[model samples]
Every structure is written in structure tokens, then in C-alpha cells.
Target: MNLKVAMTRSSSPANGLLFALTSAGLYGFNIVYARIASFTGASGSAIVVYRVLLMLVLVGLVAAILRSSLAMEREERGKLLLVGVSSALQGIGYLSSVAFIPVTVAAVVFYTYPIIIVLVSPFVEKTPLTQALVAIVAVATLGVCLVVGPAFSDLDWRGLALAFGASIATAVQFFAAARCTRTGVVAKVFWIQLIILPTAILVSLATGQLAPPSILALAPFAVTMTIAGYVGGFVLQFLALGRISAVAAGILYCAEPVVAAVSSALILNETLAPLQIAGGALVLAAIVANVLLEQRRRLKDAALVPIAD
Candidate 1:
């Protein structure tokens, strides 16, 4: 099916929200697995390489089953290539940072996407920042700081820097994706993973951490789950983004760390202090508030338009 058909089939507000939440849950679970693999002595680059390689195979099977040919126009191929390279860079930077820092710290730093989106909005959308959005942004920033503050002294500065850098790369990838979708979704994803496969492999090998998985080892299973989660999460993201506005989608994505923290506590037995819990609550509230306001505005516009028409 075409992208438009897929999106239209699930474009209701309720469906969009569910799809976005599903994406976040899958991504959160993936993060938990990645952290587990990392703690078990799998190098970050190695984990990424394994997951990307597996995802390539899995996604290929999915494409074949769907009878979808993975192809893009010559002009679009360049953008897809850039997206792939950016995806790899984001992965490398994130993994490298996690090697030095706590998973939560790295996660918080990478979750700075909302701020980046807000900063980039004027240039891309030619829209002025409203006061309410600015206030919510401040709340979100404070929440991030609170969440990471207790662990600040223990954080690896280099890791923090790399993690922040990765956030920038990811933000660019997201913005670029909004433009790239004009061509095709699966094609873009296929091309991005194509580049990711080699980039991840090269980084893994260069780090001297590219040991093939042992038959007796559990890391392979973890990597397999990670890749599965990534593919599902990404496809859901494509679906959600196509139906919702970028700002709304970005705000919803900002809630990912909360989901991550909860999953970390449950899966990894990680603890969050009271302050951290409160901070996470604030972050959730900020996202909820944004969505509520947007919904209200849409409703108001709809109610007024019928009388005028």
C-alpha cells in the first residue's frame, strides 16, 4: 500500500496517539535491551552493528512480503543517503556516550529533541514561538535538568558532550525526514539502513570490539529483540508522523524518557529518587498540556467553521 493509504487508514487522533505511544514503548524496551547488552560487555558500536545488520535482514523480509520494491528517485537518493549517514552518526554518538555515562544521563541528554525542535521551528516553519510553548519548553528543560542533576558529578563529561552531539544529529535527521517523505517512506528507511549497516560495522571493527556472537551467548538474542523493536518503533514513527503535526509528534516523543525511566526501573532494577520521579511527572504534564491545547484549538476551529461556511 502507498504511504498515503497507510496513513489515511490510521489517521484519527486516537489512532495517531496509540501509534505514537506504541512507538515510544517499543523504543523504550529497545533502550532497556541495549543497556543490558552494554552492561554485559558488548561494545556500543558492536551492539549497534549487530542490531542494524539484523534489522536489515528483517526489514528486507518485510519488504518482500509486502511486495514493495525499495527504490527512490535519483535526487531523493542523496537525501536518503544523508539520512542514513545521520542515523549512523546518531547511533555511534549515542553508543559512545553511553559507554562513559549512566544510561539515564545519556537518555536525558538525548531527549533534548523538543528544545531543538522549538529552536528550529522559526527557520523551518516560519512560525513565531508563542508564550505558552515557551513556558512549556522551560518546564521541560527544568524537568530534564532535575532528572539528570543528581547524577551530574558522576557523569562522563565526554560522554555527555557526545550524547548532546547525538541529539543534534537526531534532530536534523527528524527535520530532514519531514522533507524526505515527499518521495517515499519505506524507500527512505531502506536507504538509511543501507548506509547504517556499513557505518555501524566500520565503527564496531575500528573499536576492536566486533566479536561475532557465540552460540552459547545471550547477547545475540538481546540484539535480535533490539532490532525487532527498532523496526517496529521506526515504522510506527513513520505512521504517526504522517498523521500528526511535527510539533505534536515532537512533544509526544519528549515523553519517551519517562517511559524509559519506568522501563529501566522494571527491567534493569534501576531506581529513581523522589525528585526524579517528580521531574518525570512534570515532563509528562508538559506534553499532555500541549496536546490538550492543540486539541482544544482544533475543536474551536471546527465549531466555528461550520457556521461561517
Candidate 2:
């Protein structure tokens, strides 16, 4: 059985699904926008800094709206600090990839996280990897190969490494988010962003590549990408996750690459080859299949529960 199947067996499937899909959409568009911003000659470090700054303020407003305490338990704070480090690494990896590769290429590489999640699910989610699940994984992986094959020749090994690094960091993000929920939702989001801003700033300063965006250039992207689209989606996700399971939430995030691919093609004028599109479709289908299988398993388990005497 799939991990996603086990996750939905819990009490909050609807909310979990909603949270996951919303995060995927926000993250998809965030990648496209950030990639476009990177193409404008801003250093990757600089783009990350600016983006984190925006995220900081946005997260702050979210905390205020909820009237939640930003304080963290000492142990939780320690874990959150670690999550911050991973988040910072992910930001740098993603920004670096966008600097050297097409957004679609970067997105494809990062999309490998689903595979990673599946691989790790046995340990964390405690689900057996059935033959059917393995078959699905194989098909999905073949799709990834086909999608990425056209760009293989042009692979910047550095960019590819960064993309993989980002994937690892993203996997960590889901793990940490799930772990941190024992605390409070607002606090988790708060500390993650809180640690992110400082970490990004320090990294940018170390690289000596940080730059202030010109007022004119910052305004449009700020409103369209950062505020209305990216942040809005993220805030919704954070809120929804508080009411749902993180693993189930992570599965729903499967929609991201498709949205990112389409947006990159339309907005950045990046061309999508037929093979790549097919691969992306395969990945999407695999994710959907995984989710459905999990749901079925959960339904079966729930049906087995005995009524009170």
C-alpha cells in the first residue's frame, strides 16, 4: 500500500487533500516567478534574500491574524531551527538551478522528491511497498526519464546537483512540517520563516552577491507573484495542514510540477517538448493513482472497525 493511502485513513482527509493541493499550486507558481526573477540578472543569493524578506513579512501578518503565540518550546525551537537550515539550503539550491537552467528543467529535477518520498515512506509511514506500488513507481520513473531526456544533453551538472539538493531539502520540509504539528501551526510557520530570513541574509552576505531590488522592478512581482499568488497559496496551505496530516498533505502537493511546467511555457516562453509533457503526465497520473490506492485502503480499514455494542 502507498503511504498516501495510509495517511488518508486518519480523520481529516478532506482538509489534508485541500492543504496539499493548495501548497502544490502555490509552490509551482512560486518556482516560475522566482525563476523569471532569476533570469533578470539578479544573483541567486539576492533573489533568495528578497524572496525571504517578502516571506518574512507575509508570515508575520499571518501570525497576527491568527493571534497565535510565536513562542516555541526549547526542544521545538531546536527542531525548527534545523528546519530553517534545510529550508535555506532548499532556497539556495532552487535559486541556483533557476540561474543556470530553464524553470521546467529545474522543476523536473525537483519533482524527483515524490520518488524519494516513496522510498522513505516505508520507514516513516510504516507502509509495506506492495508489488503494485513498485510497478507504479517504475512507470512514474520512466516518465521522468522521458520528460528529462531531451534536456539531458544540456544538463548543467551543477544545476542538476542543486536541483537534487533542493529535492532533498523539500523532503526534509515535509518531514519537519509533520513533526512540528505537535506544537502549533502558527508557531511552526512562524519559526520556519523566522529562521529562513536570517539564514538567507547570512548566506547572501557571505556570497557577497546580494543586491537591493530597484523600487520599480520589485513592485509588480511583489504583488502578483509574492503577495496574491505565492503567499496566498502558502498561507492557505499552512492553515489547512494544521487541520490535516502532513503525509497526506504532501501527497496532494503532486500537482506542482504540472502547473509549473505550464506556467513556464506560457509566461517564460519556454518550449515543452512532447516527451517531457508525456513524462510530466505520467508523474501526475502516478501521484493520483497513489492517492486513490491509499484512499481505498483507508476505506477498507475503516469498514473493518466494529460498531459499539
Candidate 3:
């Protein structure tokens, strides 16, 4: 191929879907990887520390390569750094939960962030609280309940609480990310990940948790897969965003939970029961519906605006 052709991205929508779906799969695999780390004797806190350090290194390299600057106005930059707090919580909560529950279950619950965002956007983003959104939240909530099953007593409550708490933090993360448009994405990612350093270290000290992985956790295969899943996933996510609308990306990202379930089954020998599978499908459907619903409302609002001419 010529240089220009090689330099240009594929304009085909399918290409974007491929990138988005692959990223989703990588993210899905990350859940199982965290579980593996925990099973190999790494604390949840330690997993975050290790992963955060890796991300900081990778993202920092990318930022340096592109000569990206973090010189944005204080407010916008502050918003970006604030995203790290929720991100750390998101990582810590879900990773911690996987130690006590199946990765599939932790993922299923954690994926409810969009649903939580829908429930709170009215107060946060001033988005209208429409009936469709309410119904979407209800359906997704029911799906989570079914996935968790009625026997709540038997399951570890700590995992459920942590996973759900992560979901809430993820919702808040989305809001912070939305308001942080001034900084370049790469720069923001690096800085945000760097912000996780002090917080993660502080968490390690506060909880008296180890910050290093075991020998098994750092094995060639384990380290390779975890790094690929997170760092690679982060790269492909941006590639997908560059190629497709955020709305399309959001819809395709419903693949994340599906990926988590399948990968856990294949690699980790963990499978969801029939009812739980059905529940996951319901949750996915609601998430897609929510994305579509929001897009339609935005379009309608745009049409209502009178032309300046």
C-alpha cells in the first residue's frame, strides 16, 4: 500500500465496530485477569497498584511521543484529574470484589454503570428524567438482581457492595470525563493515571495491603495478558472513538460483559448459569436502549433549535 493509504484509517463503519468490540473483549478479559491475580495471592489493592503503575508508564510514553501538553485551564484540568479518583475507586472496587465473587458476577454488576448514569444524569448533567430512561434503569436493575439470584445470603455481600460501589463511581467518572474536553485525550489519560499513584499508595498503607504481586501473578503469561488487556484496550478504545461516533461506540461496548462471561468460561473455567446468562442479555439490551434513547433526544433537541440564518 502507498504511504497515504497506509496512513489513513478505514472509513468503513465495520472497522470501527471491530475496534470497539475488540476493546470490549480486552476489557472483559481484564476482569478474569484480576481474578487470576487474586487467586495467585495478590491483594485487590496490589492488583490496582501494579496495573496503575503499568498504565502510567504506557500512557506516559504515548504522551511523551506525541508531545502532548497538560497546560489546559485549571478548571478543565482539575476535572480531568478528578476523573482519576473515581477511576481508582472503580478499579479498586471491581478488582476487590472479584476476590470474593466470580469475575462474571463482578463484571455483570460493574457493567451497570450506564444504568446508574441514567438514574443520576438528571441531577448531574441536567438531562431530563424521561420515562424511557426510568424503564431502562428498572429493567437493568432487575437483570442485576436476577444475575445475583435471590439467595443473597449465600453470596458474599462484600463483593456485591464493592461491585455496586464501583458502578456508582463509574457513573461519576463519566460525568467528569464529559466535562474535561480541553486536555488532549492522551495527556489526560497519562495525568489521570499518574494521579492514581499517590492515591493507590495511600490506599495500600491505609489498608495494610501489599502493593506487589506474587511470583505467579507476574509470570510471563499473566503479565503479558493483563498488560495487553488494559493498555491495548485503552489504545483501541481511542481508535474506536476516533473512527466512530461515541453513540455507536457506546452501543458496541455492550460486548464488554459478553466478553467477560465468555473469556472467564474459556480461560478461567468459570461459566454463568442459564438464568444468569439471560439476565446478562437483559442488562445489555437495556444499555443499548439507553444509548439509542439519549441519541434520539439529542437529535430532537437539535432539530428544535432555530437556524441563525
Report residue 91 deviation for candidate 2 (angstroms). Answer: 1.6
Worst 10 residues of 2 by lDDT: 215-224
Over 43-150, each residue of candidate 3 has an lDDT whose tens digit, in order, gives: 657666777787877777776788776455577767766677888887779767876887657766776775667666677767676777677767766666555554
What is model 2's C-alpha RMSD?
4.7
Q: Which pairs of residues collide in model 3?
A: none
Candidates ranked by TM-score, best first?
1, 2, 3
Say which candidate scores most in TM-score: 1
Q: On residues 72-95, what C-alpha lDDT tens digit does candidate 1 reach at each position? A: 877667767666777788888887
Cα lDDT, all candidates: 0.71, 0.68, 0.68
TM accuracy, model 1: 0.84
What is the total number of backbone clashes in candidate 1? 0
Q: What are the C-alpha RMSDs, in order, of all predicted structures?
A: 4.1, 4.7, 5.9
- Ten residues in a row with the worst lDDT in model 1? 300-309
